[model samples]
Target: MDEHKSLADNMDEFRKLIQDLKSMSITMVDEDQAVILLNSLPKSYANFIDTLKYSRQTLKLEEIKSAINAKNIENKASGKSDADGLMVRGRSDKRQWKRNGNGLGLRTRD
Candidate 1:
């Protein structure tokens, strides 16, 4: 799944599928599973996916799953957690403002 360059959580799902497959005689069709795996990929892979799709490449599930896991691990090691990362989005924390005796503007705690 990772070698297919899928996401970590998505790869986990594939791992689960393989485990579950051992118990059941019936299994999901490889191509459908491949597409499902592809759908789990991030937008950065859009062109790659389109190329693969147009080129009619048959994706190997196990390899893709492995690749995804490795990439996710690499990302985890290199990146910061959401809370620790830069806050470039959404509403910021509210700040309390107060007026001072001098008639000039001032910021104060609530």
Candidate 2:
């Protein structure tokens, strides 16, 4: 019975030591170290999401252009030509469409 009690106490101490070591290991891993580890990952995997986003955006742009061209062709085929009238007006018209910089100000230059 005494030997069993000693073994149980040793096991408890060993478990506590393991827990302390695990906590210390976590504490040693700082934010910068974590960021460095993330950055060190393979470039292909890191850029995977960005690559898919860019490809989807490009595909959408191409689709929009094709739609616009198809509409223009349909109008032309129907003998309804107003190409010159569709051209954008002068700079004054564009001035009103100026982007409101959301209070960031006109010049973001440092």
Candidate 3:
């Protein structure tokens, strides 16, 4: 649950902890596990957490895992780094240019 760690790494650590607890006769329900995972998310995941929390009546651990994996893939694809939590996006198309009243060139909005 470290903010500096990636989601996959955190989940792996969580799974190991759960396995250790199981060996000690401690167990948690799927919903509780899901809730713990959700609660462990970093502040950067606030929006995602809210959406998942309010959009479901019952939480499924498998579904949450799948969603997290998909989001991780999406973040990677969109030039976001998990450890740094940085995302960069920009338009690749040509921008229009126009001359302002002051005779200076300015980029026009699409």
TM-score list, all predictions? 0.43, 0.22, 0.72
Score candidate 3 by TM-score against the native: 0.72
Q: Give me the displacement of residue 57 in model 2, in angstroms.
A: 12
**By TM-score, who's the top model here?**
3
RMSD of each: 7.5, 28.3, 7.5
- Please list all clashing residue pairs in model 2, or write none if there are none: none
Provide the overall lDDT of each model, using Cα atoms, as 2-decimal numbers: 0.60, 0.40, 0.85
> Which residue ranges in model 1 land beyond 4 Å of their true spot?
1-10, 17-25, 41-56, 80-86, 89-110
Model 2 CA lDDT for position 30: 38
| Candidates 2 and 3, the one with greater TM-score | 3
* Lowest lDDT block of 10, candidate 2: 1-10
Model 1 C-alpha lDDT per residue in residues 52-97, reported as the tens digit of each score: 5566667766655555556556656978321233357864666666
Evaluated against the true structure, the overall lDDT of model 3 is 0.85
lDDT of 2 by residue, 1-110 (tens): 12223323533554465469678884333333323322332332234324433555233423433443464466568775422233575644322233465844353222
Q: Per TM-score, what order, best first?
A: 3, 1, 2
Better of 1 and 2 by lDDT: 1
Instruction: State which candidate, 1 or 2, has the greater TM-score.
Output: 1
Model 1 global lDDT (CA atoms, 0 to 1): 0.60
